[model samples]
Target: MAQIQASIEIDAPIDKVWSIVSDLDSEPKFWKGTKEVRNISKEGNTITREVTIAFKDSKCMQTVTLYPKEKIQIQFTKGVIEGTKALTLAQTGSKTRLDVIWDMKLTGMMGMFTGMIKKHIQSGSEQALESIKQEAQR
Candidate 1:
């Protein structure tokens, strides 16, 4: 599986950071790779949704579990990708540290290009975190 991780420290409180990250519907605003999101179902803090990604404009089903201000776990259950993407928050002094980790691999014939796409995913993740930090700090 290809693994990518990126993190940013926001000059804001944990709650402030969480407020921005927890809004799943607004993901496309910060995460450029995520073109769109459509909710399929929700139960408590967990939600099943279909996401249109920038990679060939492919659609993927993901199970997202929100852990309040601590973490958000996204499990890719269908489509081109298979694995997990986790967002974790840590408080340092008065600031919040947001970390994004993508542990995934492309499925089927696309699997061979996993290594080739790793850098693109990593760059997108870093850009997303930076965008999140900017929004939260504002």
Candidate 2:
């Protein structure tokens, strides 16, 4: 198993940051690699959503369970990352810090390039957090 964690400080109140980060469906727009997100169903904080991820000549499907305003965790119940968890919006000195914890088991060719893959994904996460900050602050 491999793990990658990334964090960013957003210049905004926690609540405001939470409002944007908690919205699971809007993640694709902010996270470039995400192609689509469709809520399959929802029961309170647990929501099952189908996520499409863009890649070279292919796409991957991932089922994500979200704890809005707090966390968004994903796993390939059926692609790349066996599991992924993103913890959002921790308040600190008037700013919101967003953190992501990704745990995965890479297979085939993907396994050989774990370091590069992790960096790319972490960068995307950082970009997403930046987008959230801009949206919330505006």
Leading candidate by lDDT: 1
For model 2, how does the per-residue alpha-carbon lDDT over 6-103 read when each residue is reduced to its tens digit? 78888888778877777777888788878887777777766666667765523445656666556666666536545666565577898878887878
Q: Model 2 TM-score? A: 0.81
Off by over 4 Å in 1: none
Error of 1 at 7 (Å): 1.2
Candidate 1 residue lDDT tens string, 20-106:
999999999998989999999999999999999999999999999999999999999999999999999999999999999999999
Candidate 2 least-lDDT 10 residues: 55-64
lDDT of 2 at 30: 88
Minimal lDDT window, size 10, model 1: 129-138
